[model samples]
Target: MAKIVASSPGKGILHGEHAVVYGKSAVAMSVDLRTRTTVEPINKNVVELHLPDLQTSSEWFIEDIMRIPVTSNEEIEDAVKVSEALKHLQTVLNVQVPCCTDAKQQSIYAFLFLYIEISRKYRGGNFPSVKVTVTSELPMGAGLGSSAAFAVSLSAAFLAFYGKLDKKTPLSQENLDEISRFAFQAEIIIHGKPSGIDNSICTYGGALIFQAGKIKEFLPEVPPLKILLVNTRIPRNTRDLVASVRQRFDTCPAVIQPVLDAIDAISRQSWQLLKEMSNTNSLQKFIPLLKVKFQENILHLLKESLEQAELEIFEAELGCNG
Candidate 1:
């Protein structure tokens, strides 16, 4: 088979950055850039893996692949497991595929997981050793959808290389859906909890409104919503962010409830406007309401009255810069 190489973009939350981690609805996107992977088949039973961006590479004996851990409760562990699984497949097929050394240890794991999982279900083969390389334009951990994008890219690469990807046929929709589901699962392996919005957006490559627990209903396109993401310049861990919110729920429930409720209201209104607003005229009419709700609701939740300047900066950063 020809060398399989693929790429997918990372993403960030526009409004629901932390909220979605707690099963709440929020908006997120596939940013302008991504992580990529390449799978090449070699002649021997040894797999070489390289990740250019991270500057890491490693080789594994295909027969000894099952030694890598596959079960994990966290993203890091999940990533290693994926790597092990890929080695297992290489051994199973008795084919030597050189994996990239450049990807993060965890990203390599995730790549292996996607490749093996997707391959097991759709196609089986034996081949010579090959080289795989991954590159990306996105930052490693900026709350972007780096992990999901990488997973999607791997899935796409495997499907394309196997000649199993059929975008033109309606029967392929089932395969596409199944592939997306597996990709999301792989992401959960990389991210402790993912809203699946990033994968969906990267998978479809456009704008979407994501609602918690509403898979089919929540994913709707909003062409007129002028979306932009502003990083807080502060690197926030998904785990820590979720934990803080959880702590608030446990120790400060009364104080936290209103914030969540108000944010929820904003999300709802935003979705409504996204559906209703079409042309520039409609967008201009809706902009003020959108801005006001976002500012007021986020301000109240942030308890910014404590820091007027902090609140102003927050609003200015998130606000439309004209």
Candidate 2:
């Protein structure tokens, strides 16, 4: 039995949060933390999943999985049809996962879906018993895109194990694109409508600008940026947050629209400044870049640009506008 292992980096959004949902541009970079997954085909009759970070393990008998309704690839390709397919898949399977939480359940669902989909095309439904093990250095739900990394690594590992992609050429643009495509499908199962920033950055492993469905690769090589991360250890649902933003826009598009526009401008300006300042690989350039930022007050302009709209809104409400 062959074993395939793959790892993908998490992402941190530098600019554009709720705004990116509105088709505005956002900037994100791959973080140091990554999610790793290993897939091993086994002679046993059960499919297994082990998540070391969560201390979780579960298995489903191949007999039970085969009983689930089969949907053709064409049907699964449609979002609505696949969503319904999962509901059926969830109902047909009674696998009780130890340490089962909402997040774990979601991840499991995504894995099962991707596995069946890819396996159907690769091995023609002559399913084999497989064990998947996953580990992650990124904190879940800390806004660092733990799920995206999971989806990316899992998709890549499965593809490699099935010989759809050459593991040696994982860095090639063609391979990255295919890996990212499967990852995005898994993301839809996890997060209702992902901005694609996390999966793109995780697959590409560099800085990027994402807008709507388009991605502009910012840096071919990962830049050496020293960043500090702090987790508040609070539980927040990404779906709820996205829903709230959508609700806000529906209620007051005029207000939220300008804010989204401002954020897009900020993201664009940031990329421009970073490109202009550090066009070369010289370490000496960074010191001058930092100096120019503070000395010229470019940071001040960005801060004021974001806040100015709120200030104007309040002033207009109170008849303080001149």
* Clash count per candidate: 27, 0
TM-score of each: 0.72, 0.83
Supply candidate 2's per-residue lDDT for 304: 49
* Alpha-carbon shift of residue 194 in model 1 (angstroms): 2.4
Which parts of model 1 have CA positions greater than 4 angstroms off?
Answer: 66-103, 124-128, 167-172, 216-228, 279-282, 300-322
lDDT of 2 by residue, 169-278 (tens): 43677888878887887887777777788889999887888899669646765456666777999987676677756765665567667667767877776666556545
- The local lDDT score (0 to 100) that residue 314 gets in candidate 1 is 69
In Å, residue 198's CA in model 2 sits off its true spot by 1.0
Error of 1 at 198 (Å): 2.4
Who wins the lDDT comparison? 2
RMSD to the hidden true structure, all candidates? 8.7, 4.8
